[model samples]
Target: MQFFVWAAWLITIANYWFGTKQWDGADFGVIFSTMGISSLFMPTITGIIADKWINAEKLYAILHILYAATMFYLPQVDNPHTFFWVILVAMCFYMPTIALSNSISYTTLKNGNFDVVKNFPPIRVWGTVGFIAAMWITNLTGSKASANQFYIAGVSALFLGIYSFTLPACKPQNLISEKKTFAQKLGLESFKLFADYKMALFFIFSMFLGAALQLTNAYGDVFLDEFKLFPVFAESFVIKYSTIILSISQISETLFILAIPFFLKRFGIKWVIAIAMFAWVLRFGLFAFGDPSANLWMIITSCIVYGMAFDFFNISGSLFVETSTTPKIRSSAQGLFMMMTNGFGAVFGSLISGWMISKYFTTYYTNIGSLSKYVNSEADNAHLLNFLKNKGITVLQNGDLSRALDVKDWHNIWLAFTIYVLVIAIVFVVIFKHKHTRAEVEAINHL
Candidate 1:
């Protein structure tokens, strides 16, 4: 249920921004920035509360319920400014639950004497399943961009929120049993992990890779719907139900997550992460060339690669931290990992992508008059072709008038992402030296 709330709208918001609200592309940057800003502080603040004052599970439940309530009110707002505030409020409640959920799971596993390394992955896979199911529900009900989708998310969140309260109680360990400084109480001491040269480099690159995480979420659906500009592809399943199509990535995530332990054991973290980085290269490059009709395979393959691209780095990185970091500051280290990837990483990714889209991917074609000015270069022509192909719109390849394609423009965007991934992969290969071993895994579990 937690995963579903995010999956339902994350990918489709760009469609809402560009298509339904007719908002400026730059404004969408500010919209996505809300998640980053919220992430910067909310999780740590909530973590402090869970650690010092309240039961983690109860806090998790309350946040989810609050998130659900805010989501219920989201569809009522029409203005972009109002939507931003509402979504920000929703994120404040929603983001912390991610950390809280992990704490709850880890605590529960430890209490049961079960190996979290061995058991938690299977349980977490269900969350991805939940996410995929919600996407399908939204798509089948024709509510991907409708207010109804919020209600779908809200209702599910409410259930999960309440259900969370019933889970095994997770109490504070009170690691700081004696009087301590403010920084120590807040887990700020974990920042010392940065002093280790290898750990510092790993975190630095994590932030860089984290930036790529939100790119597809911010624009994938918008990219698909942009296809409607072309007459030939607009009515096709990919354009019309792009959110559902993109759900394939989450579906792939569930399967790939199960394979992580094997891959980690066989290849080591460096190779695993390098493969994940290359997967991102394929992901964005595929989008550069794929269309709804002829290149549908490219799109699907990109979605498949997302599993490896995302899970390899995120889950495996977390495990790496788990096995390496001291138990006294393990939770704090995990939060730091998240801060790098989801907080700083998301902020940079959203801001940069928004700028690139507004400045570059958006182009005016002189030949089509008013229509050309509004179309997106990436998917607009494809959409135009889709409309012509499916709806029989007349398209003329003219002699006197020529269509100016944004060839150099989009090439730069893909090139930027490719370079970013390549650099991250190379750095990971050169730095990071920790190896996972049975004894190390056992020590981590004992913690």
Candidate 2:
């Protein structure tokens, strides 16, 4: 859990708007979207190798080692093109470990005579704790604005890589004697889920929601850091501690996870998910208007509500898939769920959002000394100015025209995303029909 958080916690801040290291949001989008692209096949492909050839633990260890290699080199990546490819290599190895970790946990627990369903949620909560710890570490160590967060993760991955060899072996289920079809041997049978009407709809919507998930991840810290452009809010705690502040959302997300069972019991999947859609509305809306200054509480509240917005749809959606699928396809269905959310959804969201941000919201600037109201972050000033220059924006110095300080139009950008999620909620309510009852809620226990 610590390693996972170390790997992810400060990515947006470290990659997006950090002083000298800042990359274009679109470039960051390309970097981040690689996880989705890799997810298209890596997990399934790796699963095949692990199931038929290598031990799962060994495969996981090697991936982490490779991932660490890429991460350690990230600080030296000065250009967006190189940044794109470097993180792509890292994500390819890192993304598969998500599924592998769950597999390891389940197999290890079961081997010890423990019930996975009952024990896993508690164990999973540690990931959230680790996320918060990582955020705190990044901020406290001043790595939130540096590339050291990647170093932290790289070192952790190295440690984890070596330690993984010590875990119980997870041998392949598809041995030579097992007469499996070529598709089954490749774990491609799950692709058949696309043929089912309900499942097809579910996965489609999962992709849409998955896009929403990437929005906050891509820009939440950038949003907070942007306040440094202003006077009063520049020294504000929220700006100074943007990464830590964003960690509130993850902390809140953890707490909301605990409420899933009760909400599932009472409201069932449909309402729980509807509530989640509504929460996304609130989440982005709050961020749209809230600032690091007076409306800071609204931003904090938005982070708090993120728990409901994220967990209800994602966690509950997993349960929906679980109860809906047969045991044979259950694992694959979950993978499909992840692919829709984290893969296709992430790719779609990142690319579109990145492009949109670059096209419409790219901050234009005049002289560096002009709109830089408070602190003198010349590198950030120069970066944004250079970014606008590349966009062919007309930025001059000293006049009515000189005051052309058109920074990121975050309001419209977020409003667009808010409308996107709102439309998704409305369409979902009308088309996706499920009659939820108390009996349906019983499936949570089986998980």
Cα TM-score of candidate 1: 0.85
Per TM-score, the best of the predicted structures is 2
Clashing pairs in 2: 51-172
Q: What local lDDT does model 1 show for residue 244?
A: 85
lDDT of 2 by residue, 231-318 (tens): 5564689887888888888888888888888888777898898899989999999989898877988899999989999999998898
Estimated TM-score for each candidate: 0.85, 0.88
**Model 1, position 189: C-alpha lDDT score:** 85
- Per-residue error for 380 in candidate 1, Å, reads 13
